[model samples]
Target: MNKDYFKLTGEKINIEDLSREIVSDSKDEEIKKELYDELVPKLRELHAKLFAEAKYGILVVLQAIDAAGKDEIIKYIFSNLTPQGLKNTSFGKPTEEEESHDYLWRINKGLPKRGEIAILNRSYYEDIISPKIYDTLDSLPDEIKNDPELWNKRYKQLNNFEEYLDENGFKVVKFYFHVSKDEQRKRLLERIEDSTKNHEFSFSDLEDRDNWDKYQKAFEEMLNNTSTEIAPWYVLPADNPWYSRKVATLALIDVIKKINPKFPEFSAEDKEKAEKIAEQLKNKEI
Candidate 1:
């Protein structure tokens, strides 16, 4: 695996220069199904070790444009894992109560506990990007919104936030589903044409389409400013959902491998105690 293939090697990224589809020999579905079939099991194994060790947790933040298959691919990747300590949270538009607090406050609800794995479909990330696109920051102070350095400050705050999470034992991994403008147009149209998919379409989606460039610029700035060694970003080419899933699988496993959790070891006395209890149960001696 190329250690930095999915990472930002430089301080600046021109979103226009990025490829929206991976170069692959196999079919789109085969890319994910075959390449990821092996790694999904490895992900589960690592997840089990993570839970058993109960000393660390991981936060996977899925950031994408509309119709980029963030939800679809997440289900495909983690579908088979036991739900015991797994958490999936989608943070949509803020409620009135959420709007009353600091931008990162609502994130507390989506955070994972030690021994748990959490997927934040959208996260405190929205506070940085969405408001930039819509040009609204009612949740924030009037003074800050008018400042020229508001976004840069927010980016620094986000870096500090993730750094805090890392210090407290939660590893942060971010995935940006990089879909091209043409592919987004096609998918948005498909949502309108397919009767089964009509529910996914809305005029608001088109509203976002109008500001696509603004959103791209916001994404580029966020990635450049906030991507750090402790919490790196993986840019997944999302025009082909399957291909993106395949790449995401590799990146996911790579991060978990680095985390390298192991099941806890027992002391001799604890092991003997457990063995005796097991033997008593086996012999039907209550």
Candidate 2:
């Protein structure tokens, strides 16, 4: 995947200008499969190295509309990672404690420790997008709720927070799964009709779908305002599950490769002790 086509770092993004289906230049399914097959093992290897190095952390934030395939993409691409090194958190409706805190408080608590990879299925961005569309700002403080510049202020806060993470050795990668309205409807219907997926369907999903245009505007503003050099957003064409998975996988691998985590170097004393222990093992000493 050409990362630039999907990346929105320091660029104004118009969701209308982006395709929700596979781009014309996207690779065929065969090529996508081949690339995916190659990338997964490489990602696993990098993730292991990252865990051992304990020098950097990775935070992957996934945001999408209903039935945009966030769950599927995360499962397929990241489930291969070692449980010890990877943490996946899905943010749904906030709990009482969470609701009492600032929107990013739960998100902060979920951030990865050094040398770990944290995947957020839905994140603080939801605060901006969903609430903006639904006008569900009653829970917020009056200053934030009533401020005309609330969205802009929130964007600045997010940018500063992400920059702080970056400066503190956490690399942030965000994905916006861009599924078409028709595709989303198709998937939502499948959820209702497919027995195995019935549990995933809810009346609220349909209600949210009714505000699709509003959500799109909110998403576009979110992407344009918050995509920065430290934490860029990738808008994946999500109509084709296979293609989106491949793109997401490739994007992650690209970031990890850039991070270039490695096994920690041993100190002189540690190396001497390791050699002694190695010699003892070679001699079959208990």
Candidate 3:
């Protein structure tokens, strides 16, 4: 009911700042639970409207550090949306085939179709991170990789691709699940300690952990470069899984509300035809 809901207001919401509001300790369970209770219904209503007014499909991009609760956020925040109108896709380690193509090619294959909501778990940002961390591009000949001009060209290409999507009527909403390093280590250790959660851990995650600082720098640059009026990023505080889901829900619905798409209109002729059919039924003589 708040008219000002989801208005970014150019306010800088640091993850550390918002985490202070979350009742991480035992005393705040009631406050946390109440927020969840209130947030879910608002999300459900927004989803229903979005589903009906499905002219413009919404693409939600979720990016986060490992053990940042990306899966849990998806499971909780979108639990109420009908499967018929929603599509969820997760990108794993790139295949040999994917590695051979332009980075956006694989991601472009996952864009939402008309009249649907598409959620991308991790997106094209790997171009920035993968190259920076692995130095894979450095292996290329100096004719290509060594040129600052070539890298600038790729960044421009990425920006143009996103702009093209917007011009074609896709509503893009990107969220970065902002988890602190301390929380990340705690989560990874929990996976090690809990047999049930062990299945979620991958050996490759350690390799990623080795480059944690590099990835953080990668992410900051990616956010800075790709953050645009059309596809802005929301850096969600994800230390508390509950709060993460709540903020994701709030952020998504807020974007949907801003789009304010209306259902397709029927022509007057279509209404007249409907009325004639109703009149025949009333007469009951045919």
Candidate 4:
């Protein structure tokens, strides 16, 4: 199935192409209204099937730059997934306890059990992408102090982790929300200028913004290294929130569609037993 939201490695999609197809301008309010109307119900139906199947779990990892609408996309796509069948985790800097352990320890603890869908807001890619780009190497052991091959080794480790998950019946779908720097600047400014959104702004966000070029280079490298047949990364367009949500929802639904587990078929003996029970209840008053 051609599940790409926007092609990153090949000919990339234009902002206007995504905007026209995914979301019209806020001036055209009808697009958002219509898209959401169609979105929620269809997602709910997929959730019901995904929940009932009970054989496999889906791990959805969303990685995005600041103001790329990751939070908004999560809220919309998972609105209908039952709480029992779903779990959402947002990763941040390691706590003291988390810091004491290996990098994978915190992330492995967040994995979903069978028949559940776990949404990782930002995932272990931070271990590979963030530390390398930001020079957060103070925590690394002395053995790997300045090794040039450290990144390649980490990528191999990630591939092994994903391979293990796939063998154990977990489907990992990772998304990289690709927003242009200009678009990110616009959204950040919107938060800065509006009093209501001021609370969402952080000093660290600005620091990250300053290293925008470095982060993009890191992201490009990370995606190229980690994009495997077992666990593919979908580079999603994040310039339009409405369209992003729709695309995410559809991508998830498509994955769930592959696991087509119907309610079990009844045998002749089972049918006979049910018939006997039904005949006994026929005399009861409605």
lDDT of 1 by residue, 1-286 (tens): 4637777633578887777876664586666667556878888888888888888888999998798889887678867565776899999899999888888889998899998889999788888899888876865677988899988888889999999999999999898989988988999899999999999887888888899999999889878888888888888878877777777777777777888999898789999999999999999997
Model 4, position 243: C-alpha lDDT score = 62
Score each candidate by Cα lDDT: 0.83, 0.86, 0.71, 0.75
Candidate 2 residue-wise lDDT, 1-286, digit = tens:
5768888898886789998887443555675666557878888898999999898999999999888988887677788887899988999878888888888898976799999999998999988887877777777889779999988899999999999999999999999998899989889999989999998888888888999999899899999999988899988888877777777777888888898888888799999999999999999994
lDDT of 3 by residue, 52-121 (tens): 7766778888887789887887776676676777888888767778877767778876788765678888
Q: Write the per-residue lDDT of candidate 4 for residues 1-286, one digit (tens) a residue.
A: 1446453333433333432134445723664565567756766666666677677888989897788888877666685567788888999987888877788999986788877889898999988878866777776687784888988988899888988998898888888887877888888898899999998777788888898878877787777777777887776767766666666776676677776644444699999988888887896622
Is candidate 3 or 4 superior in TM-score? Answer: 4
Alpha-carbon RMSD, each predicted model: 1.8, 2.0, 3.9, 3.9
Model 2: weakest 10-residue lDDT segment is 23-32
Ranking by lDDT: 2, 1, 4, 3
Given candidate 2, what's the lDDT at residue 72? 84
Winner by lDDT between candidate 4 and candidate 1: 1
* Inter-residue clash pairs, candidate 1: none
Candidate 4: list runs displaced more than 4 Å. Answer: 5-34, 263-286
